[model samples]
Target: MDVLVLIGRVLFVVLFATSAVNHLTRSKAMAGYTASRGIPFATAAVLASGVVLGAGAVSVAVGLWADLGALLLAAFCFSAAVLMHGFWAEKDPQAKMAEQSHFFKDLALGGAALVIFAFFAYAGHDLGLMVTGPALSLG
Candidate 1:
Protein backbone atom coordinates (compact mmCIF):
# COMPACT_ATOMS: atom_id res chain seq x y z
CA MET A 1 0.00 0.00 0.00
CA ASP A 2 2.77 2.41 0.89
CA VAL A 3 4.59 1.46 -2.27
CA LEU A 4 1.50 2.12 -4.33
CA VAL A 5 1.03 5.53 -2.77
CA LEU A 6 4.63 6.42 -3.50
CA ILE A 7 4.20 5.25 -7.05
CA GLY A 8 1.18 7.46 -7.39
CA ARG A 9 3.12 10.41 -6.05
CA VAL A 10 5.91 9.80 -8.55
CA LEU A 11 3.45 9.46 -11.39
CA PHE A 12 1.72 12.70 -10.42
CA VAL A 13 4.98 14.66 -10.54
CA VAL A 14 6.58 13.00 -13.58
CA LEU A 15 4.78 15.23 -16.08
CA PHE A 16 5.84 18.44 -14.40
CA ALA A 17 9.37 17.18 -13.70
CA THR A 18 9.96 16.13 -17.28
CA SER A 19 8.46 19.32 -18.66
CA ALA A 20 10.52 21.51 -16.36
CA VAL A 21 13.67 20.33 -18.11
CA ASN A 22 12.09 20.91 -21.48
CA HIS A 23 11.01 24.37 -20.41
CA LEU A 24 14.57 25.34 -19.54
CA THR A 25 16.16 23.74 -22.59
CA ARG A 26 13.69 25.35 -24.97
CA SER A 27 13.31 28.64 -23.23
CA LYS A 28 13.61 30.84 -26.29
CA ALA A 29 10.93 29.05 -28.26
CA MET A 30 8.70 28.68 -25.24
CA ALA A 31 9.12 32.33 -24.31
CA GLY A 32 8.15 33.35 -27.81
CA TYR A 33 4.94 31.43 -27.56
CA THR A 34 4.29 32.78 -24.11
CA ALA A 35 4.85 36.33 -25.34
CA SER A 36 2.43 35.76 -28.16
CA ARG A 37 -0.12 34.99 -25.50
CA GLY A 38 0.44 38.50 -24.13
CA ILE A 39 2.32 37.48 -21.05
CA PRO A 40 4.59 40.28 -19.83
CA PHE A 41 8.27 39.62 -19.43
CA ALA A 42 7.73 36.44 -21.36
CA THR A 43 11.29 35.17 -21.18
CA ALA A 44 11.56 35.73 -17.46
CA ALA A 45 8.10 34.33 -16.92
CA VAL A 46 9.07 31.18 -18.77
CA LEU A 47 12.13 30.65 -16.64
CA ALA A 48 10.26 31.44 -13.45
CA SER A 49 7.50 29.08 -14.47
CA GLY A 50 10.01 26.35 -15.05
CA VAL A 51 11.46 26.91 -11.61
CA VAL A 52 8.04 26.82 -9.99
CA LEU A 53 7.19 23.61 -11.81
CA GLY A 54 10.43 21.98 -10.78
CA ALA A 55 9.98 23.00 -7.17
CA GLY A 56 6.43 21.76 -7.09
CA ALA A 57 7.38 18.50 -8.71
CA VAL A 58 10.15 17.84 -6.22
CA SER A 59 8.09 18.78 -3.17
CA VAL A 60 5.13 16.67 -4.21
CA ALA A 61 7.15 13.69 -5.34
CA VAL A 62 9.10 13.61 -2.10
CA GLY A 63 5.95 14.32 -0.08
CA LEU A 64 7.70 17.11 1.77
CA TRP A 65 5.53 20.20 2.15
CA ALA A 66 3.32 18.75 -0.53
CA ASP A 67 0.48 21.13 0.19
CA LEU A 68 2.60 24.09 -0.78
CA GLY A 69 3.72 22.23 -3.87
CA ALA A 70 0.12 21.54 -4.75
CA LEU A 71 -0.75 25.19 -4.31
CA LEU A 72 2.07 26.24 -6.56
CA LEU A 73 1.05 23.86 -9.29
CA ALA A 74 -2.62 24.68 -8.99
CA ALA A 75 -2.04 28.40 -9.27
CA PHE A 76 0.26 28.05 -12.25
CA CYS A 77 -1.97 25.63 -14.10
CA PHE A 78 -5.07 27.75 -13.61
CA SER A 79 -3.34 30.93 -14.65
CA ALA A 80 -1.83 29.30 -17.70
CA ALA A 81 -5.14 27.88 -18.77
CA VAL A 82 -6.76 31.29 -18.64
CA LEU A 83 -3.91 33.19 -20.22
CA MET A 84 -2.93 30.68 -22.89
CA HIS A 85 -5.96 28.53 -23.61
CA GLY A 86 -8.85 30.92 -23.93
CA PHE A 87 -10.90 28.84 -26.32
CA TRP A 88 -13.79 31.24 -26.38
CA ALA A 89 -11.52 33.90 -27.80
CA GLU A 90 -10.52 31.76 -30.75
CA LYS A 91 -12.47 32.03 -33.98
CA ASP A 92 -11.21 29.10 -36.01
CA PRO A 93 -13.13 25.96 -35.22
CA GLN A 94 -10.13 23.68 -35.10
CA ALA A 95 -8.13 26.14 -33.10
CA LYS A 96 -10.97 26.68 -30.72
CA MET A 97 -11.31 22.96 -30.20
CA ALA A 98 -7.61 22.61 -29.56
CA GLU A 99 -7.58 25.44 -27.08
CA GLN A 100 -10.61 24.04 -25.36
CA SER A 101 -8.86 20.76 -24.90
CA HIS A 102 -5.80 22.43 -23.51
CA PHE A 103 -7.92 24.55 -21.20
CA PHE A 104 -9.77 21.55 -19.85
CA LYS A 105 -6.61 19.57 -19.36
CA ASP A 106 -4.99 22.33 -17.39
CA LEU A 107 -8.08 22.93 -15.36
CA ALA A 108 -8.38 19.27 -14.50
CA LEU A 109 -4.79 19.04 -13.41
CA GLY A 110 -5.12 22.22 -11.41
CA GLY A 111 -8.26 20.99 -9.76
CA ALA A 112 -6.52 17.81 -8.80
CA ALA A 113 -3.76 19.76 -7.20
CA LEU A 114 -6.24 21.84 -5.22
CA VAL A 115 -7.88 18.67 -4.04
CA ILE A 116 -4.54 17.32 -2.96
CA PHE A 117 -3.92 20.51 -1.04
CA ALA A 118 -7.23 20.23 0.70
CA PHE A 119 -6.61 16.63 1.60
CA PHE A 120 -3.31 17.33 3.26
CA ALA A 121 -3.95 20.81 4.52
CA TYR A 122 -7.56 21.04 5.66
CA ALA A 123 -8.38 17.52 6.63
CA GLY A 124 -7.86 17.29 10.41
CA HIS A 125 -4.54 15.67 9.71
CA ASP A 126 -1.24 17.21 8.77
CA LEU A 127 -2.47 20.65 7.72
CA GLY A 128 -0.45 20.03 4.57
CA LEU A 129 2.36 22.26 5.83
CA MET A 130 4.68 19.31 6.29
CA VAL A 131 4.82 15.71 5.26
CA THR A 132 6.07 13.13 7.71
CA GLY A 133 6.38 10.34 5.18
CA PRO A 134 7.42 9.91 1.59
CA ALA A 135 3.89 9.04 0.53
CA LEU A 136 0.26 9.70 1.55
CA SER A 137 -1.61 6.65 2.67
CA LEU A 138 -4.78 5.60 4.45
CA GLY A 139 -2.61 3.79 6.91
Candidate 2:
Protein backbone atom coordinates (compact mmCIF):
# COMPACT_ATOMS: atom_id res chain seq x y z
CA MET A 1 0.00 0.00 0.00
CA ASP A 2 2.69 2.44 0.97
CA VAL A 3 4.77 1.48 -2.02
CA LEU A 4 1.87 2.13 -4.33
CA VAL A 5 1.27 5.55 -2.89
CA LEU A 6 4.94 6.38 -3.12
CA ILE A 7 5.04 5.34 -6.75
CA GLY A 8 1.96 7.39 -7.54
CA ARG A 9 3.52 10.42 -5.95
CA VAL A 10 6.69 10.04 -7.95
CA LEU A 11 4.79 9.64 -11.19
CA PHE A 12 2.62 12.64 -10.49
CA VAL A 13 5.57 14.83 -9.63
CA VAL A 14 7.49 13.80 -12.71
CA LEU A 15 4.83 15.23 -15.02
CA PHE A 16 4.84 18.66 -13.41
CA ALA A 17 8.59 18.87 -12.90
CA THR A 18 9.33 17.93 -16.49
CA SER A 19 6.75 20.42 -17.69
CA ALA A 20 8.23 23.15 -15.52
CA VAL A 21 11.66 22.56 -16.97
CA ASN A 22 10.16 22.83 -20.41
CA HIS A 23 8.37 26.09 -19.63
CA LEU A 24 11.45 27.61 -18.07
CA THR A 25 13.73 26.45 -20.85
CA ARG A 26 11.31 27.25 -23.66
CA SER A 27 9.72 30.36 -22.31
CA LYS A 28 10.18 32.29 -25.55
CA ALA A 29 8.52 29.66 -27.67
CA MET A 30 5.74 29.06 -25.21
CA ALA A 31 5.17 32.76 -24.80
CA GLY A 32 4.98 33.23 -28.55
CA TYR A 33 2.42 30.46 -28.77
CA THR A 34 0.51 31.89 -25.87
CA ALA A 35 0.49 35.29 -27.56
CA SER A 36 -0.84 33.66 -30.66
CA ARG A 37 -3.69 32.37 -28.53
CA GLY A 38 -4.42 35.95 -27.46
CA ILE A 39 -3.42 35.59 -23.88
CA PRO A 40 -2.04 38.84 -22.51
CA PHE A 41 1.40 38.93 -20.90
CA ALA A 42 2.07 35.62 -22.55
CA THR A 43 5.72 35.43 -21.52
CA ALA A 44 4.98 36.25 -17.93
CA ALA A 45 2.07 33.81 -17.82
CA VAL A 46 4.17 30.98 -19.18
CA LEU A 47 6.99 31.71 -16.74
CA ALA A 48 4.58 31.96 -13.83
CA SER A 49 2.75 28.75 -14.76
CA GLY A 50 6.06 26.91 -14.89
CA VAL A 51 7.01 28.13 -11.43
CA VAL A 52 3.66 27.20 -9.95
CA LEU A 53 3.68 23.78 -11.58
CA GLY A 54 7.15 22.96 -10.26
CA ALA A 55 6.48 24.29 -6.77
CA GLY A 56 3.09 22.60 -6.46
CA ALA A 57 4.35 19.26 -7.71
CA VAL A 58 7.31 19.40 -5.33
CA SER A 59 5.11 20.30 -2.42
CA VAL A 60 2.73 17.41 -3.14
CA ALA A 61 5.55 14.94 -3.72
CA VAL A 62 6.84 15.63 -0.22
CA GLY A 63 3.37 15.92 1.33
CA LEU A 64 4.20 19.43 2.42
CA TRP A 65 0.96 21.37 2.71
CA ALA A 66 -0.39 19.46 -0.23
CA ASP A 67 -3.63 21.40 -0.10
CA LEU A 68 -1.89 24.55 -1.20
CA GLY A 69 0.07 22.66 -3.76
CA ALA A 70 -3.08 21.15 -5.12
CA LEU A 71 -4.67 24.56 -5.37
CA LEU A 72 -1.74 25.84 -7.34
CA LEU A 73 -1.96 22.95 -9.74
CA ALA A 74 -5.72 23.17 -10.02
CA ALA A 75 -5.50 26.83 -10.89
CA PHE A 76 -2.79 26.27 -13.44
CA CYS A 77 -4.53 23.33 -15.03
CA PHE A 78 -7.96 24.88 -15.33
CA SER A 79 -6.61 28.20 -16.50
CA ALA A 80 -4.43 26.55 -19.09
CA ALA A 81 -7.33 24.40 -20.25
CA VAL A 82 -9.42 27.47 -20.88
CA LEU A 83 -6.83 29.85 -22.26
CA MET A 84 -4.72 27.42 -24.19
CA HIS A 85 -7.03 24.70 -25.37
CA GLY A 86 -10.43 26.34 -25.81
CA PHE A 87 -11.79 23.41 -27.69
CA TRP A 88 -15.25 24.92 -27.91
CA ALA A 89 -13.89 27.73 -30.03
CA GLU A 90 -12.62 25.39 -32.71
CA LYS A 91 -14.64 24.95 -35.87
CA ASP A 92 -12.74 22.16 -37.53
CA PRO A 93 -13.60 18.72 -36.20
CA GLN A 94 -10.02 17.48 -36.12
CA ALA A 95 -8.76 20.65 -34.50
CA LYS A 96 -11.59 20.54 -32.00
CA MET A 97 -10.79 16.97 -31.12
CA ALA A 98 -7.15 17.81 -30.53
CA GLU A 99 -8.00 20.85 -28.43
CA GLN A 100 -10.57 18.88 -26.48
CA SER A 101 -8.01 16.23 -25.75
CA HIS A 102 -5.65 18.79 -24.32
CA PHE A 103 -8.45 20.45 -22.41
CA PHE A 104 -9.57 17.22 -20.80
CA LYS A 105 -6.04 16.29 -19.97
CA ASP A 106 -5.59 19.51 -18.06
CA LEU A 107 -8.97 19.08 -16.40
CA ALA A 108 -8.02 15.60 -15.33
CA LEU A 109 -4.85 16.84 -13.73
CA GLY A 110 -6.79 19.56 -12.01
CA GLY A 111 -9.28 17.03 -10.76
CA ALA A 112 -6.49 14.93 -9.34
CA ALA A 113 -5.06 17.92 -7.58
CA LEU A 114 -8.46 18.71 -6.12
CA VAL A 115 -8.75 15.19 -4.84
CA ILE A 116 -5.33 15.44 -3.25
CA PHE A 117 -6.39 18.60 -1.53
CA ALA A 118 -9.53 16.93 -0.31
CA PHE A 119 -7.57 13.97 0.97
CA PHE A 120 -5.40 16.20 3.09
CA ALA A 121 -8.17 18.42 4.31
CA TYR A 122 -10.83 15.78 4.91
CA ALA A 123 -9.43 12.28 4.57
CA GLY A 124 -7.91 12.26 8.06
CA HIS A 125 -4.31 12.18 6.85
CA ASP A 126 -2.03 13.56 9.51
CA LEU A 127 0.96 14.34 7.37
CA GLY A 128 -1.02 16.09 4.67
CA LEU A 129 -1.11 19.44 6.43
CA MET A 130 2.68 19.81 6.54
CA VAL A 131 5.88 18.43 5.12
CA THR A 132 6.02 14.79 6.11
CA GLY A 133 9.13 13.52 4.31
CA PRO A 134 11.17 13.60 1.13
CA ALA A 135 9.66 13.17 -2.33
CA LEU A 136 9.79 9.39 -2.17
CA SER A 137 7.63 8.93 0.93
CA LEU A 138 3.99 7.81 1.00
CA GLY A 139 2.66 10.52 3.19
- Whose TM-score is greatest here? 1
Query: Could you tell me how far off, in angstroms, the CA of residue 49 lies in candidate 2 after the best superposition?
Result: 0.5
Q: For model 2, what is the alpha-carbon lDDT of residue 84?
A: 96
User: Deviation in angstroms for 126 in model 1?
Assistant: 7.3
Q: Give the least accurate 10-residue stretch of model 2, judged by summed lDDT.
A: 128-137
Tens-digit lDDT track of model 2 for 44-139: 988998999998988777777666777788889999999999999999999999999999999999999888767656642534334553222234
TM-score of each: 0.86, 0.85
**How many steric clashes between backbone atoms does each model show?**
1, 0
Evaluate model 1: give its TM-score: 0.86
Off by over 4 Å in 1: 122-139
Candidate 1, residues 1-139, lDDT tens digits: the string is 5566557768988988987887888889899889988999998998989999998898877778677787888988999899989999999999999999999999999999888776656541433333553233432
